[model samples]
Target: MTADREITRRHAGLLDRLKRPELDVDETDDEDLRHLELRRVVLEVAELDHAQEIALVRAAVARFGKAGQA
Candidate 1:
């Protein structure tokens, strides 16, 4: 697999992990921090120069909104 593909895979996996109910809690400081970090990873992965990855990131951000935001 290529670097772009690898990044895409990682991004998708992270998205899947974020979508879990356990990760959706915003009621605690720890949960908020974890959510922020996960979102940071998502945007970082989205910065890659690939069309598919860009689209994936767009969809994710559209669905979840930007990182570091409550």
Candidate 2:
């Protein structure tokens, strides 16, 4: 398969996994859970337009930046 096709396939798989409500938390380790959560976030961000993406980044920074500075 072409690289683009492979990437699209992988993305589809990730989206399917994210949508499943039957996922057992006990079946995955903490790191796997974090990775899945991160994938979900990235997929959500990908749906936003440029302006919305910027707004999300700004909001995230406002919400979490202070904690990092401490």
Candidate 3:
């Protein structure tokens, strides 16, 4: 019917848009890796303290043991 043709046309348009070749240096594209900004803000983690780190390591060992059992 006419509705089916309209749906097919819409789907085709979407497919064409997806198939279109992307620009090598696409600044507007979000996936463009060329202009990626990396920020560093180093903050000390309290959980990484000596005693807490030992506790974390023990917990990880327990979790791994349980995982191996399964």
lDDT of 1 by residue, 2-63 (tens): 99999999999889877446554546876667767866577565666578778888898786
Candidate 2 minimal-lDDT segment of 10 residues: 19-28
TM-score of 1: 0.26
- TM-score of every model? 0.26, 0.27, 0.31
> Candidate 2: deviation at residue 31, Å?
40
Ranking by TM-score: 3, 2, 1
- Model 1 alpha-carbon miss at residue 28, Å: 23
Candidate 3 on 1-70: residue-level lDDT in tens? 9999999999998898776685665556744452353322122323346787799889998798689788
The true-versus-predicted C-alpha distance at residue 3 of model 1, in Å, is 0.3
Write candidate 2's Cα lDDT for 1-70 as tens digits.
Answer: 6999999999998898775576566655866667677666775657777888799999988879688788
| lDDT against the true structure, each candidate | 0.73, 0.78, 0.67
Over 4 Å off, model 1: 20-70
Give per-candidate clash totals.
Answer: 0, 0, 0
Q: List the residue pairs that clash in candidate 1.
A: none
